[model samples]
Target: MSIHVVLYEPEIPANTGNIARTCAGTHSHLHLIHPLGFSTDDRMLKRAGCDYWPNVQIEHHDRFSDIPEKYPNAVFYFIETIGEKNVYDFDYSNPDADYFFVFGKETTGLPSELTDQFKEQCFRIPQTDLVRSLNLSNTAAIVVYEALRQQAFAPIAIKEAAD
Candidate 1:
């Protein structure tokens, strides 16, 4: 009943690290599909993620297709610029269902063949024509927050200020 952020062939260490930090804060699991651009121990990655690396739950996969096999019952949504539906249009309020947000690499997006196969599950963040695409980390945070909002930020939503 939690959210999972899946990065497909992410090429930038900083972006992945930042996303990992976001995942740690939101209590979401992170799935990284190879082949990764940088080693898991890269300094930039650690720096961007700060000291939150231990707080993040990360799983690495050798292939993208292996994700579905691992989480057969979870609902998956692929994020792409050419997606048919807007991210806000989807309902992420199911407390009993596990949701996975799949994003592409920094340079080239998810494979067209794969996206085409799951065309109905594809989603995109609205943007102006001024920019080609949003940054990978930014996009992941935006979508993750939206999903969290729809679910009323359950489990992680705090009402009282920390002392």
Candidate 2:
């Protein structure tokens, strides 16, 4: 199973860079929507991402509408704090469905109307009363790892015994 992460107007370059590294490590794809807070040419991101940026599969889109046309077969999932379904409750191991984990800007999330449009596709990470939410990159890591876990932590494998 492959994983795709969508960041809408990401605000921080460092965060985006770190997420890029994560995606590279996990063999996932990262998508950045237009009107980004920092230029994709920014040195900070490339520096933090450190030589792995090129290895990471990243795509840029002018708008949300542009994305759907390109990835018609992928399942788009909006991650928000108020989602009806917790991330844990969702089945992440469907080999047939390409999983897309979508996150909004750090300061303000996606327009409520947009989220409502895909209400059934929205999900949230469980949290305690003391915390409102997690950092965007951190949250992405959590969800991706969980999905990876469901896929049997694809990174690990048993070596065949030498005869």
Candidate 3:
């Protein structure tokens, strides 16, 4: 199965870097949506990611809708603060179809319009108490592992899936 980690307008390069490293280690595809806060050449991200940035398989998308064109067979799963379905409840392991795990900007989360437009596409990562949400990279790490666990941690399936 193929997995795509989509970050919607991520603000912090370090967070993105860490997420990229996680994606590299897990062998998941990383997608960074447009209007990023920092440049791809940011020193902080470079430091946080070290040399792992090149190891990760990443794609850049100008818009969320562009994703479907790139992976027509994939399912888009957006993560947000308020979601009808708890992330834990969703079946990440289903191998019948490809999946894309979408996340929003760290500061304001996702745009309401996008969330409302894709209401059925939204999902939540379970949290407790006063915390609003987890760090972007951390959240990505958690969700990616769950997906990996479900897919038996397949080895770089993107190349084959795109074929």
Candidate 4:
């Protein structure tokens, strides 16, 4: 019933922190696959999350394969530059199942070996050569919001319960 954002071998602490903040705001879970470039307890990371750490549901894993083992039925969408389809191409209408959006590290994106296994599920955010790729946090936000939008923007507590 929730979305999961996976950062594969993330190299930057601030990016992860900012992503964590976004996840907290959207009620999504943040998954970090090691080995991270910076320690999770880093001060800069803490500063970037800006006191929202308590609100974010974070998980750590030693390997990416561990995620599939944990959630075998989870739907994964790999985010990489080589993906033939953009985010808008997919139908994320299933709100009952957990959607896992896998984003590569800030440096070198997800390995081709991994993407090859799930090429159909891979997606990219359109951009020009103005930069190598969009920022990690920015990309995550874009994909998550699109998925949420496709789902009618429901199931995320659009309104609080009335007494």
TM-score of model 4 (CA atoms): 0.91
Lowest lDDT sum, 10 consecutive residues, model 3, at 154-163
TM-score of 3: 0.86
C-alpha RMSD (angstroms) for model 1: 1.8
36-56, model 2: which lDDT tens digit per residue?
998776485455646788888
Best by lDDT: 1
**Model 1, CA-based lDDT:** 0.91
Q: Which regions of candidate 2 fall more than 4 Å away from where they truly are?
A: 42-49, 155-163
Candidate 1 stretches with Cα past 4 Å from truth are 42-49, 157-159
lDDT of 1 by residue, 65-151 (tens): 798898888999999999989999999999898999999988999999879999999989999999989999999999999999998
For candidate 4, give the lDDT. 0.89
Off by over 4 Å in 3: 42-49, 156-163
Per-residue lDDT over 53-135 for candidate 3, one digit per residue giving the tens place of the 0 to 100 score: 77878899899889988788898778887888867777777777778998999999988988898898788878885897888
- By lDDT, the better pick of 1 and 3 is 1
Ranking by lDDT: 1, 4, 2, 3
Candidate 4 or 3, higher TM-score? 4
Model 2, poorest ten-residue lDDT window? 41-50
Candidate 3 clashing pairs?
none
Reference-based TM-score of each model:
0.93, 0.89, 0.86, 0.91
lDDT comparing candidate 3 with the true structure: 0.82
